[model samples]
Target chain A: MKSLNLQRVFARNTYLISFILLVIVLGINYIVQNNVFELRVLNNNLRTLLPLILLAVGQSIVVIGGGLDLSVGTLVSMLSALLVTWVTPDSTPDQILLAVVLVCAAGMLAGLVNGLVVAYLRLQPMITTYATSFIFSGIALLLLPRPGGSIPRDLSTFYRSPLLDIPLAFYAIALLLLFWSVLRTTRYAQYLYATGSSGAAAYATGVPVRVVRVTTYVWSGLFAALASLTLMLSTGGASQANIGDDMTLDSIVAVVLGGTRLSGGQGGIAGAIIGVMILRVIRNVIFFAAVPTWSQTLVNALIIIAALAGPGLIRLIRRSIGR
Target chain B: MNAQTLRRYLTPPLIALLLAIALFFAGGLINPDFINVTQAINIVRLAAFLGIISAGQTLVIISGGEGIDLSVGAVVTLAAILTFRITGGDNNLIGVGLLASLSAGFIVGLLNGIGIALLHIPPLVMTLGMTGVVSGTILVVTQGEMLGATPALMSTYIAKPLIFGIPGVILIWVALGVVMWLLMERTTYGKHLFAIGVNRTAARLSGVRVERAVIITYTLAGLLAALGGFMLLGFAQTVLLNLGDPYRFPSIAAVVVGGTMLTGGKGSYWGTMSGALVLTLIDSLLRAMGLAEAYQLIVFGGLLVLLIAVYGRELNLRQ
Candidate 1:
């Protein structure tokens, strides 16, 4: 009975396990490169990781709200395409600012489409987003048929520079966490969790289930737009139609690693951020470990599979032991 | 027939057939040659690849519990590469190549089934992860060098014009479709699949071997996807790095458009056939229209969303 309770507690707090895993990976990364904590390395890594971190945070909300947004990557592409295509070389700061606001709004609008379709039309989230993904990418492709556009170099340089002795990315992370903590205290968050955990029960309990679900996706879209902005900053505002495609899967992996149940109503964004960190650190390990270029993709995939399967295996073992 | 009977007859396939006919005429309006008999053959020939791939997809979807095989595209690619390596364009080694591809698919399907059933991983994540693993493995193994040529026998018989100027692949597709139809509609396994899909615990309580059925269904899907890859090799005569990428989403699109629920359990293979043809016709029409790749993608995506919305909305309302 005691063992069962212990196992149950462990299962209940998967984030704790993820934290340990993150620490272990960081330790390994430090051993590989002793100067990993140097400001330069930290800044470079954090900046590179910011986009995925933001994406995973968005994805966690959707997953927690019992939906999945396959188009998050495409949304990123679309916004980036819009930003670079509109923000020409000689564009004024006001124009750039206006373009940013419009692109973010467009992202929210796109999310509204997804939310409306999935929540109101009652379409399956998986297939619906999958289809819309093409639409988003198609628009992105139309905006920039080829991958040749530039944001202002000064803007990119400014984004790369540190602010007040700390990297800009740290502040961004802090802001996101603050937003999440504030949101968590709201009744809507409780409703969101209730709806995801059991929609029928939540409805019976007078929760506005549909509204909560739709808002979650809308929130996802806003975060996706933010991720796109950070990605553009990191990549010097160059845009590709498929730039965000790869990150879709990576964010999902991060969410799973962070102990967010795909089934819904479990886990949090904090774990998701840690999950992204773990994935990035592992990528760094693979790079520094001198793995062959040909085998790199395969090695990364294998590690992902391991990470995705690990928690499930633990739960299974726990169940068997309990029995 | 009464309205109820008529409505029953107007299944997703029949609806798809009607749409296809309209699209066919629309294509003809764009270019008179599009309505020719040759065009019909071309459409079916193109659809043969999707049909075979989707045959397995339909089964997986029917197995339910949010069952889907996102790895189909990757599996097809891996199978094609492995077959090419095994056969090396040698007709004599074709049998060995087929066996090699099917075995590879079986192993993957088995792993997917085990993970989803015994290990309790979500099908979406499990298959998606499998796609990465399989694609990554292929990249490492091939090192960007895709080998092997289409054997003359396959090209001549299966791909090129044969008896009555019809491709052999279309005939094979018909045969496979019929067999899958019978297997799903006429057999005990079919009933078991539907039951398990409808409700797993209930099915288990009723003494259905749910795990075995799921395992078999996924294994079959994997094998068929590999077979489809072989067909693609025959048609294209050579494989490229992203050869199977095009078929990945379309197969799923076709399956869904054909009336299969994404949530699974209730659908028909016949519906999927028309869905494949409809999707193929759209592709041909888009190409014929001289649309850029971007527009083509937009149309494809938009049409799929429209179809899903049209079908799915009614189901939700009824519920």
Candidate 2:
């Protein structure tokens, strides 16, 4: 009975597999690099992974709400471009803060555009976001025709530095989790899941499915803004038009690895966060394993494909065995 | 045909045709040199590559289940690289190169089919993952090196006019277009494809081999993408890393602009052909204007959104 109960609990927790995978990968990482858990190393690693972590969190919410945001990465790029262009190294702290607020607003506005088209206009989310990605990338290119910008060294130093021996990234992550927990308790969360699982059913039941869909994109945009800000600070404010282009797919991959259904309404931000960490650690393992430079991409891609196929393959095998 | 039936079949392609012509004249206005017949032939020649690749995309999209082939670009790159390696700029080995490239594409498509159709992986995820795998394979084989060239005869065929100021490549595209039209309109496979796309469960109940049809569609898409890559080698006259990368989104965009529902079950290759021409014209016009890559991206994306807004909206409220 106890074992059955445990099995049920495990089945109930969609992220359990992702969490286990993370633990295994972390262990491999530690074995490959003995000092991986050390404070400074841990902090540095998390710092680098944080931008993607934030992006994945946003992607998770969007996916959970029954939509996808291919434009999130470009939105990050555009925001980063806007940030670097707006705030110079010599700017006052007040100016930097104001720029950050404005950048966040722009990010939300971009999301609103995506949402309105998808929600009211009833366009497919994937294609809509895919189309809009080009616009964001174009804006990014226009803003930073060349990859050049400077943020104050002091700002980056502050971001890198620990307060009370805890990394700032940890605090940011904790705050994000806190925010999610709060949001999850609200009625909006219920509506989001309902809409995602079955929009028609949800609409019949009095849910404002369109509004919920629109809000999901708004949240995604806001998180993307945060991700862009984090990325800019990490890179010392040097901006590139294509800086965030690769992260879009990576974020989706991370979200999936976290056991979140791309079909929506079946996952959490925690799993997505863990998924990002697993991905990062897997890269670390590759680096420490000293795989040939030429074969690294091959190895990485093979591993990812295996991971993506694993769940389906397992189910197939189990069913065949039962037969 | 009655007006309703004619309108249903013709409206999308008509809009695309009108757009292409408007853009052509618009290009002439931007650059006086762009209005000539020579330039028009050049645009068609260039569009042929995109059209061929999008031919596969059209089949995949029409098969429904949110089908897409992101790996088309990677397959193109792989095929180009493979062709260069096989032919070594020798015309005598061109046939061998074509066979090898097409087989490689077939095998990749087969894998994609098995994953999506049998294993029940989502098409988007399956194809995206396949893209990574294919790209990784390319990197491994090439080791990041630039090597080999197109056969001299092939390059000439692609670059020079063959009959009535039309490049041989354009003729190939025209031939492929006709074959595609016949395949989609007259074959049992095409009927199955449409039925499956429109309603998978219903098709299955009605005795359609949904999996087999989907697998074939994806396989053909892969084959066509490889063909595009082979032609690209001729047009480019040399191999380049990620040669097909530029066509990935454009192929989908062409299919979408051609009035094919991304949701599946309604579209035509003729519409896709016109859509490809429109896209090529947009590129030419933008280039002629001397706009920066940034502005070009802006206009291209803006135009895609505007075009889709014009015709791609879902009629259902619960999307």
In the order shown, the candidates' DockQ scores are 0.57, 0.63
Give each model a TM-score. 0.95, 0.96
Q: Identify the candidate with maximal lDDT.
A: 2
Model 1 agreement with the true structure over A1-323: per-residue lDDT tens digits: 88778868878887987888889878988888788888888989999899999999999999999888888998999889988888877889999899889888988889888988888888888889988998999999999888967778898888888898798889988998898899999998899889788777887888887788888888888888989888988888788889998788778878988888887888889888999999998888888888898888778777766776766788788789869
Give each candidate's fraction of reference contacts reproduced: 0.58, 0.64
How much DockQ does model 2 earn?
0.63
Error of 2 at B260 (Å): 1.4
Pairs clashing within candidate 2: none
Residue lDDT tens for model 1, B1-319: 9999999888888898788889989999998878888888988899988999888899999899879888889888887887778888889988988898999899888888888887777787788878877888888889998777767887887788787999999999999988988999899999998888888999999999999999888888888888988878888878777778888778888888888887677888888898999989988998988999998989888987888887754243223
Which residue runs does candidate 1 get wrong by more than 4 Å? A318-323, B314-319
Q: Give the C-alpha miss distance for residue A187 in model 2, angstroms.
A: 1.5
Which runs of model 2 end up more than 4 angstroms from their true locations? A1-11, B1-10
Error of 2 at B64 (Å): 1.8
Report residue B144 deviation for candidate 2 (angstroms): 1.5
